[model samples]
Target: MNARLVGSGSDTVVLAHGYGTDQSVWDKILPDLARHHRVLAFDWIFSGAVKDQDMFDPVKYSSLDAFADDLIALMEEVKPGPSVYINSEGYEGGFDISEVEQLLSSIESDFHSWASSFAPLGVDPNDPPSVTKFQNCLKRMRPETALSVAKLIFLGDQRDMLDKVTVPCTFVQTTNDFVVPNSVPGFMAKKIKGKSTVEVIEADGHFPQLTAHLQLLEVLRDVPGFDL
Candidate 1:
């Protein structure tokens, strides 16, 4: 259960990468972050490293609560100390997280409009991130793994957990990003109890790490203690 660990420092900053990418997506910004805060990043169980397909039991990490738990566990193992920075998704969505419950409810009760409640990203879902490299990586994902994860992303509501995190949090939301959309970031900021900042970068791609790295880095540095 010892998740991947990277970097070290008192002001620990964990990077939570979004769907279709792993910890390495932060490669461009880590050097800058490592300059000041301890940065820890890891791939979620489905992002490719996990071998035990059964280990990805739907009951466990199939929800945001479970995924966040894995994150907290990694943080506890690497740096249990106070963290001044917790840069998450610093960008947009895999999809409407609450959609899973909605879909299930709709299915069970003869409702037909639940799926429509989700706001589309206003982009082609079939198209990959604007970055070619990311598209290439995604095209190579294990089909079963991706399908399983797609189902999981549509499930549950864990935005409430934001109220529990005592650490300072900053989300890097892209104004022009499509996959995660803008509203998802808004929901996250409102739910997380601690002081959180949101920077709306004028970026086009969902993988801002590649298409909008400098802007993201600029915002990252501008955030309170992220002076790294």
Candidate 2:
């Protein structure tokens, strides 16, 4: 159960990558953050986990809470409370009031923009988005299945944990995000009721690690109270 760790400094900062992208997504931003703070980044189970797999089964662990539970457990072990936390496209909970969810649900009976966020994996930073890859990820997934995952992620009510988290967090969000939308981070900033910064980095795609590395790094370098 060895977790990947990076950076070394007194001021600790952690970055959690979204579903499709791995911890490597933070490669560009790490050097910047590492300049001042101890940084930790890890891949969630479905992506760059110790053991990643295709298709997340709801029966085994069930729900994003399971992944979040593991994250909290791991964070407690590595860093009790970070001076800053960068949840790329992960955790669409508190301070989350995305109109996208409402719009999606209205148009289709089944809509899971949060879960289907993995779709952006088609766009690699090195390669960017290929028409072929984008069509492939979506080609197999049905609207109902996509919606189910999205609902689970977007509707994931983790407001309870927000009060518990005493760390200063900086949520770097995208402009027209689907799951972890601009509003989600905005809602979180106000609701978290702790020291939290929302850096609305305008870029294409949901995964900032791939689309907006420099912008993300700027947020890390200039984060309030964090010297890193």
Index of the highest-TM-score prediction: 1
- Candidate 2 C-alpha lDDT tens digits along 124-195: 334444323433443344454444455666566676676676666777777755545456777777777678
Per-model lDDT: 0.58, 0.59
lDDT of 1: 0.58
Q: In model 1, which runs have C-alpha deviations exceeding 4 angstroms?
A: 1-8, 51-54, 84-130, 159-167
TM-score of candidate 2 relative to the true fold? 0.64
Query: Relative to the unseen true structure, what is the C-alpha lDDT of residue 36 in candidate 2, on a scale of 0 to 100?
Result: 70
lDDT of 1 by residue, 1-228 (tens): 324545666667666665555666778887877776676666677665444545565566556667768777777667547665443343234545475455445533432222222112322233344344454444344555555565555453455566787656677776766556677777777777778777788766456676677887887778775565
TM-score of each: 0.70, 0.64
